[model samples]
Target: MENARSGNAGKHKTRASIVEVAARLLHEQGTAAVTTRAVAQAAGMQAPTIYRFFEDKDALLDAVAQHVFTTYVAGKRLVEDSDDPVADLRAGWDAHIGFGLANAALFGLLTDPNRGTRSPAAAAGLEILRARVRRIAAIGRLRVTERRAVELIHAAGTGAVLTLLSSPPQDRDLGLADAMYEAVMRQILTDAPALPADGTTAATVAFRAIAPKLPMLTDAERTLLSEWLNRAGDDPASFDASHRRG
Candidate 1:
């Protein structure tokens, strides 16, 4: 029993080590740079050993998503004490941006269309994200629909961060960037006709507006949503359409 436990521990450690090294390579050099042969070399393991842990490139990329969501986005929380819906929204916004900036590579993989919907790891990661959105909605502060509010708030904030990351040197200013973020957020919270606050708490108001329309998704639909959410990192069009049409 002791030997068996020791062997399992060693296998776990090796798998973890591969994931760490692969994540670094993907983040630093992008997914294309993280070939099985290259990752094996970097991990100081043979190619076949790497294959033992992951079925294929997609599987490894899914593991990369796992690392990003688990290590970074998973622990994110906002507005722990604030009852103000606006304040809670802002806190959630900031946390979302911070996570993207901190984990650009994993963010990239999560967004890649080619990554597809094969890996269980990616599916699990999306479930974690969905729970976080639910929590943010439960904060009882915002007047917009809970899921839509969560989606819009995140799209605006993280969209801005993506812009900054992709910006040219001459166009980047952190202070001005933050100001722009604040302005966009205010408009999103107050200006949208679809998400008006009519004498109710922001969260409740928002939830009510969107509750009837929230997609009655099958399990496959949920998986598709995960893929779409990640893809929205590059283009918000599909995600926007889904929310509006749903």
Candidate 2:
């Protein structure tokens, strides 16, 4: 048992070290520097050893991206939410923008549709955004459905980073992210929870946040209610049919 445990620990250590080296290479010299040979040499291991933990260069790159994003998510999850959900949401946005700008190569890898869409780390990041948007909806401040609010914030953040990155570092418009955030907020938020006066949109969003927790409803009933609520929450007042993402 002791020998087996030692072997397992050693394997875990080797994999972690390889991933660490690859992540450093990616950050310092971009994706081309993260090849299996480069990583193995940097990690002081044979290239074939990388195959024991990862199938190929793509898998190696995936692990590197995963490790980098997982570290960011760990720290992000530790931030305590304040009494003000909007303030918390803006904090998250700023952190996301800073992370993207700092880890340009990793951000590029994780935003590539073919890889980003398939990454668990990216999905976890999106879940964090969903929770932030859900809080605003629960407070009745959101004018759009939770899904729409999340989508708008995500799209804007990505665009903000890409636009900033396109410019020379010395010439980048740092305030564009703030401007984009305000634009999205204008579209998705109200002055406050106006309920019956602001009408069904905010009410539907607030209710949608708690729909699954209605203990009196059966599972099937809750599912059906959620479907209806989703339709209503994304109704004409909340969603414009013409602006859907491609």
Say which candidate scores most in TM-score. Answer: 2
- For residues 1-246, what per-residue lDDT tens digits would candidate 2 score against the true structure? 999999999999999999999999999999999888899899998999999999989988988899999999989899989999999999999999999999999999998998899988899999999999988888889888888889999999999998898888899889999999999999999998856766777887888887777799998899877776776676743333422421
Q: TM-score of every model?
A: 0.63, 0.91
**Per-residue lDDT of candidate 1, residues 1-246 (tens digit):** 999999999999999998889988987887788899999999998999999999998788788777666565345432153545445445655666666666666666655556625545445544544444444444433334445544554556656777766866467665654785676556435433223234334534434334445679677766675555444433445655666786
RMSD of each: 9.6, 4.9
CA lDDT, every model vs. true structure: 0.61, 0.88
Query: Candidate 2, after superposition: displacement of residue 230 in Å?
Result: 2.3
Candidate of highest lDDT: 2
Backbone clash pairs for candidate 1 read 85-141, 142-202, 142-203, 143-202, 143-203, 143-206, 144-206, 145-206, 145-207
Give candidate 1 misplaced runs (Cα > 4 Å). Answer: 77-85, 113-141, 168-170, 175-180, 187-246
Stretches > 4 Å off in candidate 2: 216-224, 236-246
Residue-level error in angstroms, candidate 1, position 203: 9.3
Q: Model 2, residue 78: displacement in angstroms? A: 1.0
